[model samples]
Target: MEAVTKYSETELVLLLKQRQQSAFSYLYDNYSGALHAVILNIILDTELASDVLQDVFVKIWRQINSYDDTKGRLYTWMLNIARNASIDTIRSKNFQNNKQNRELTENVYESAGSTQLMTDKIGLRKLVHQLKEEHKVLIELSYFQGFTQDEISKMLNLPLGTVKTRLRTALIQLR
Candidate 1:
């Protein structure tokens, strides 16, 4: 932690570009939690957030030299990487299903423990809860569950275009 405070962000980035261990250690120690917060805010799943954080760091390691300091701050670069990686993870097939299973297990556990206490607590959940049943179902299966549009269509017994349209609408609503 002391070492992290030793260098400015630009200096740390320069060391990282040179593949310095101390720099990497300092970046991870100082910035990983902040990066993780951004990733988890978008992903909203612990396991997916963990995977995205790993991938984000790996990307930063690989692309260190490609970074142009003129474009933005080092923190911005890292934040962008984390966001892109988490979005990619969300778009992946495995993540969709895994996300769904995780959600279901959590919901079941929550309901079992205290149903009334968990009713649409967060802003996102509250907004999602306000959606029509079909839109809500599609959003759940596609985004949170990590199902593809085709998979969601098949699961819901709806046309492919319908699923796509609903998903688009749901995402627009979320935004």
Candidate 2:
């Protein structure tokens, strides 16, 4: 395939919607590194991050037509996909043991972003570290880990109202 450097992001999106192999190659080459870094920040393990990244790309490929440019840009949509996929993986039962192991030794609440196993995620860690403990818990469980507010309430053994309040409060504070 010839180099696809001429088209703008919009054109690339159109090509992607058309299922052009060259467009996909170009998108992967340009965006994979940044998306992979975002995944690694959430997953905190290379192998798992790699697996999640692949899934994100596959979703991007399959769901390209669902993208509405009126709502957001392509990279933004892809980032959301990567972030959500990583969160979903972390929230899975398969990773519950790892989560418990981390919880046993580290007070992830005190500085939820303090643990930086990956150098590239320092920015993400620092941002999370600034949140209050309750705010961090709500954000971690509800956003980063992709748990529904109801699931978060059950997991944290909090009342549903309390879970929703905390989650809402956390976002307001973050903003």
Candidate 3:
């Protein structure tokens, strides 16, 4: 039987930052399952979830330098990456278009009542569409697409304070 290796979080972080393959392997062996579970909850498709899991590990390996122990645990940082990756996958243009195509096909075969139910499930998205254009864009990017405020600011070429203020106003209107 192969023996397992244990590492303190600090030791693991140090080794990972140093680009040690053994440390990465150990990290993956210990945390992949939990990280996969987190991705699965967001993605729901097993195959896609597995792909996202692999991407998450690669991201963790590459982004280890950005992980701040003073801010949070290593696992928590990794969890956030897994979650964001899953959400980003689902929000991709290809994914959205594919989902729409699938829904259209399903709706054609589904009963009228079921079609209405599916439409109702999009209530929040529909409401966001009703918001003013600026607020709507901010809400969709930050909430529906899981982008951070700073990311949205850079993408929209807007100031960070403007993004936050608009997001706050949008939430208030949503209430």
Question: Which candidate gets the maximum TM-score versus the true structure?
Answer: 2
lDDT of 2 at 128: 56
Model 2 bad stretches (over 4 Å)? 1-6, 93-121, 157-162, 172-175
lDDT of each: 0.71, 0.76, 0.75
lDDT of 1 by residue, 73-120 (tens): 988888878866765775564445657755643443343234223435
For candidate 1, what's the RMSD? 7.2
Distance from true location, Cα of 17 in model 2, Å: 1.4
* Rank ordering of all candidates by TM-score, starting from the highest: 2, 3, 1
Ranking by lDDT: 2, 3, 1
Off by over 4 Å in 3: 1-3, 93-95, 98-175
- Per-candidate TM equals 0.55, 0.72, 0.56
Backbone collisions counted per model: 2, 0, 0
**lDDT digits (tens) for residues 40-136 of candidate 2:** 7677778988889999999999999999999998999999999888877866734565557456223434334454444334445556556787777
Task: Return the lDDT, model 2, position 7.
Answer: 72
